[model samples]
Target: MKIRDKILSGILLVLIGVLLGMILMFFRQGTFSFDLAEVKVTEVNRSESPIWTDDELEKIDDRFVFKTIAKTVTPSVVYIETLINARDRREMSPGEEEDGGNFWDRYLPRTRTVGSGVIITADGYILTNNHVIESAVRDGINVTLDDKRTFDARVVGRDPSTDLAVLKIDAENLQNAVIGNSDRLEVGEWVLAIGNPFRLRSTVTAGIVSALSREVQIIDDLRRIESFIQTDAAINRGNSGGALVNTSGELIGINTAIATQTGSYQGYGFAVPSNLALKIARDIIEFGEVKRGLLGVTIESVTASTARRAGLNEISGVLIIDTVEDGAAAKAGVQSSDIILKVNGVAVSESNQLQEKVAMFRPDDQVTLTIWRDREELETDVVLEEMQPIVQETQTIPENNFDEEQLGPEPEMWEEIPGDENSGIEQQSFRELGFSIRALATPEDPDRFNLYLHRVQRGSEAWNRGLREGGEITEINGNRVHTLDEVEKEITDSLKNHRSLTFKIRTGQGTDGYYQLF
Candidate 1:
């Protein structure tokens, strides 16, 4: 009995020890759970900390940048509407009722065109493309501003060579765009195109400057001047005359055209550089016309063949094909085969670049030209001249002292001959030249006889060459012809020889000019 009691006491002690250990473990586990909760709270606080400072945040906000530019520049962009009168349809002749009975539809139709423009002055001077307002009716032009204010705009002036026009609106306190230096613009710099594209007002598109000094023959003028800035901006039909601004909301260019196969934007857009646009605008505002300087030298871009012939290491500079007589270049001793390397210290690689550079000057501006001739670099100072329209001298022939009755029968008899007659052969041959003439004698000056063109056949070479009714033929093949017989004989002989005939003619306004018929 004494041994069993000793074993039972030992078992009771072991149970007390086991219960105490369990209580200690439970308390320790509770403390560990409290510590873990504190660690999680600290981690959450760190993660919630601001990733960017206030200044940094503002700097990185591209939306804010674009929005600020749009807001500042959009007000300067205006929408333009132009109305053009359509030509009258020809009256149908008798038995020509085959034109669906719409003959003699004397109703004139007016065509409406939409475009964009940029305000350049506080007194409401706007700049746009000349093509946007070409042939626009005087009272049919209107401008709509951002504030929904509409005003009738008058054309200040237009320069077809540069495809630019200036307009004046009768308003005050207009929002004007700040002109920026396009020469300072770098490729890949961000830009914004603001305009009314497809008549959608206040449209803004973002892009980058893709190129500079791009030459695209978008203008059809004979003396076209193009030095365009190329971009990837979205430009459409109505975007012409819009503003192309930089990130600072300064106008760098005037959106002019887009290179696209479709009528809409296809990733390539063009603009007139701000410098050139501003120059043209200022000139028109001050002078009512663009006074373009002329170099009087026909130039071509340097090609591989030309470079090789000139012994050039690389195809660069402009090759002078010919120098006009008594022109600025001729006076400056510039000759054909001379390679123009630079104008006024600016390197020129193409003919258009040189032309544009020269055009920026005034008529009397003295420009220094660096030329490469005979493996030597030579510099010449050329004083620019005003570009004049090609004018020919009217060759006046002395009145015939012979009597009219001895020359031929009555003039009306020539018009009444049958198709099989000899006179008909002469008439048919004359008609093949695509014009008819009549001799006009002035009652006040009876001895003065003039041959005036009364008709020009449609689609004829004479008509295509800009000959019109009322033009007086002054000379043919360098010979003064006073009678219709002499004129017809010269034309027939030239036709038989298959040679081009040159006619010196005088316009109704007394402007003398020459035309070629082949």
Candidate 2:
């Protein structure tokens, strides 16, 4: 009986051990049964395998790229503050003497303006917009570096045509910005604008290059060079002199202006291309001023109508309206009505682009201009000359006492004609052209008839073509037109013949001038 009981116990112990082993195996594998069909195994071909797949390598974070650029570029941008003398306007009692106003006003008040700039040289050469330091008072220009070190800055030179200026700070070991090739920048490429906007230092804004070779006409100077890089960056008044850099943290442009109605960012901002800005900066440093080269020709963009008139196969290139007498273009045999297609192998489609391209060179630099005339493409080598400063004399006209009605009965009869239809021109309204002229006696010389332009419409073709109010027309189509009848007849004949009407006129300053009415 004892032996049988011991055998039962041994059997029970063995069964319990076997059950524990099965439970442990089930927990380890997380299943009681294994199915080969439920498993997935990828096969590798070592001969065709790459160390890393293209998709895996391309999954770089954009945040890392932007952060790297910011880290590299922000150190080169600086803040500029200018102090200008302000004019005082204090009202005085009526009985007070004029001396009272003059004495106090002589003590000019100081006004502070803030801006941004980029360091281009390690030795402390900085580039900024001219307007930032235009009228700054003596000993008032200040520059602050990234580390908050402030120093007094001196103006090296300024070029108003390009709205650029160079400044120098008395500092060494500065981080200078790396300039990139602006010509290689394309639309849709990412860019960053760094500046002190609204007095906020180290402000950064990101955008894409919206366009290239844009002529915004923000600069009021007649010789303004505006091949701007248009961006959607949020640039404000204080950002005018800041740096517009690429993803590589290389400077490509200088933020200059914004297209806004509220004096703030409204989606459109413009920058001066780095190539042109650097050229002007270098010229200023070397010559103490901008050494601009001139082609010496008045040019206009080719429109469809202009293309038809000039007999061009395509509506492109800049149309040379007139060549300056004895100038580089005239000496190069460039004639009026010729279309300039290229400058130094680069195609130019606008008058401003041609102007900018030529302005990039110094005086006496040789340039090859591709011109289209009589349906033939001709290459002409032109040695540029230094552009002479245009000296314009201001004239103030006195209010006239003579009435239009008193001088009018004959003028009224002339006005009865259907001026628009008789000329057989389309969309050519005399008013839309932006000028109104009246046949009047030349007060200085009554014997000579003069057509005085009393009203010049703003933004009109005439206004844009540089015609000003108070100018006098002396001839039409190269013929002396002393009377209104002769002037009308000449315009009618030219329009009927599909010829552009040329005018020989006198400016408000009594200087002789030539203009074309198309």
Taking all chains together, each candidate's TM-score versus the true structure is 0.63, 0.70
- Residue-wise lDDT of candidate 1 within 238-317, one digit each (tens)? 99999999878899999999998888999999999898899899999999999888888766667666678788888889
- Tell how far residue 372 is off in model 1, in angstroms: 1.1
User: Could you give candidate 2's per-residue lDDT for residues 58-148 as a string of tens digits?
Assistant: 3563334666677889999999999876642344554466543455555777888889999999999999999999878789899999899
Cα lDDT, model 1, residue 508: 58
The 10-residue segment with the lowest total lDDT in model 2 = 408-417
- Against the reference, the lDDT scores of all candidates come to 0.79, 0.80
